[model samples]
Target: MSEAALPSRPASSLATPLLILGAVLALAPFTSAAVALLGGAAIALVFGNPFQGQTRTWTHRLLPLAVVGLGAGMDLRTVARAGLHGIGITAMSLAVVILLGLWLARVLKVDRDAGLLIAVGTAICGGSAIAAVAPVMRARAHQVSVALATVFLLNAVALILFPPIGHYFHLGQSPFGLWAALAIHDTSSVVGAGLAYGKQALEVATTVKLARALWIVPVTMGIGMIHARNNKEVAADAPPVKKPWFIAGFLAMAALVTWVPALHGAGHLVALAANRALVLTLFLIGAGLSREAIRTVGIRPFLQGLILWLIVASLGLTLVKTGILTVG
Candidate 1:
């Protein structure tokens, strides 16, 4: 059997204890999202993650639930309004980033599938987007891995830097949230940065990012159709596209809270618990950022991802700061 088929075991005697300690720190009430990520990364880099498979599985399961839980604290009207307002900008940005990323990939001589995966990840929802599109494009394993690693590295940086940058620029809560939602590659990082900023920012960022994530469906379908048209084998062999059901769950939670004023007190508690879960989810994400993953992100692909990200982030910031992008 392959290593994946084997049961999870600690890499070393210290791995379990260290992981336990990291989990405790991540869930601690005072721990910030950035700090949780840093701590987990530190442990993974130093001792390695023995439970890599388990970590990936849990992170996948927990992140969506946490996002759904956060919805309990949101008003449906606000979420709807933010989603509507962001759709146009999100679509435009996605198109620009996808085109720019592809051009940069060609200029850098990166692998076509890898370049496309990186571009899709950057344009949409990071690893989730990459994961959604990869099989349809018949992306190689290394291509998907490199794309994920590049996006993960940038996500770590964005989570840490965005809050300080927002404060430095004296950005309003909603503006900062809008910028984070637009610029950050992953929903986790966007929510983390928004959380670090303030309540209003968190609400705005989460709502807008979730809204932006909805594009994954159409984009994946479009890519699949294009690939199928060029190569019939692609349509025949491609795996079914997975829907982001968490978004609907999130909306349901928001609606429940919105319609029932009596649930507000309980919703607040659930939201708080969800926030803690998100921090832990980040810790798991960081722990998966092993040194091997970093080394796998070779120079050219990393450069392509980095350049594309910088362009998106800078443009997003300028628009938000100049009042060209605002979230109600």
Candidate 2:
């Protein structure tokens, strides 16, 4: 939808649209993000920005809470196995994507900060990775916003494309899960793709993606240290970011599910709640993907992200096809 057609509305008038959005999210959990994305854009086209006051609350606060909530349904043993199995692929893909993205950014004459954000987002978890590293890199607000937009755009595409591609290849749950985990940037897309594939795919993808996300702390700290040594002026200006404590919540929840025998009977209920929470999270993510955010993203950053993702996706599929990156 075009931006010009959207008219600004007061907060009071948003009640109807918000209720409509909630109902849609509940009814169509699987396609909530895609729906919210198109529906949000349409909302913008018709009613102006639908996320003025609540965007931050939804994206920053609610989303992570939902992810942590998901952990309750996961077992520590299964998560460990998934993490160990995915290490080789995750490490290899991350290194290759970062190096390739850096070279591509230089070739395309993109800004280094924006390039790094895109590379990190492509290599690890999408917006979360970028958000964690941005403060350490002292990235400008516009750069962070643009990089996030770029990742979100690709995530939307992945949600639609990866499932069909996996099915066309007749990939088993294990390989398809690995493919989705490695190729998709964000947890939402990974989960979305996996859900479209099968139940087993969702289980495997969730564990692998969460394991991959743990790299954010070390990666951000290492980058910060490098910047400090090479460019003291930039390092001095960089803001310190708190370590992501949400990860601990996720791990702890998994441990609880695994070790606490008493909670075993509650598995179904926890899983149901978690799935609903994820639907809500995706809906919020889509609603926050405003046209203004997309407008801030430059052509070069978007190109860099697309190219990096293509390279990673190709390499991941090849490894799976070759048995080099087999799923347990």
What's each prediction's clash count?
0, 0
Every candidate's lDDT: 0.88, 0.75
Model 1 lDDT per residue over 136-234, tens place? 787656677788889999999999999999999999999999999889999999999999999999999999889888999989988877777767444
Please name the candidate that would achieve the greatest lDDT relative to the true structure: 1
Local accuracy of candidate 2 as per-residue lDDT tens digits, 20-61: 665366446455444544565455435555455575466567
Report how far off residue 233 is in candidate 2 (Å). Answer: 5.2
- What does the lDDT come to for candidate 1? 0.88
lDDT of 2 at 290: 55
How large is the C-alpha RMSD of every model relative to the true structure? 3.0, 3.9
- Predicted model with the maximum TM-score: 1
Once superposed on the true structure, which residue ranges of model 1 sit more than 4 Å away at CA? 1-12, 232-241
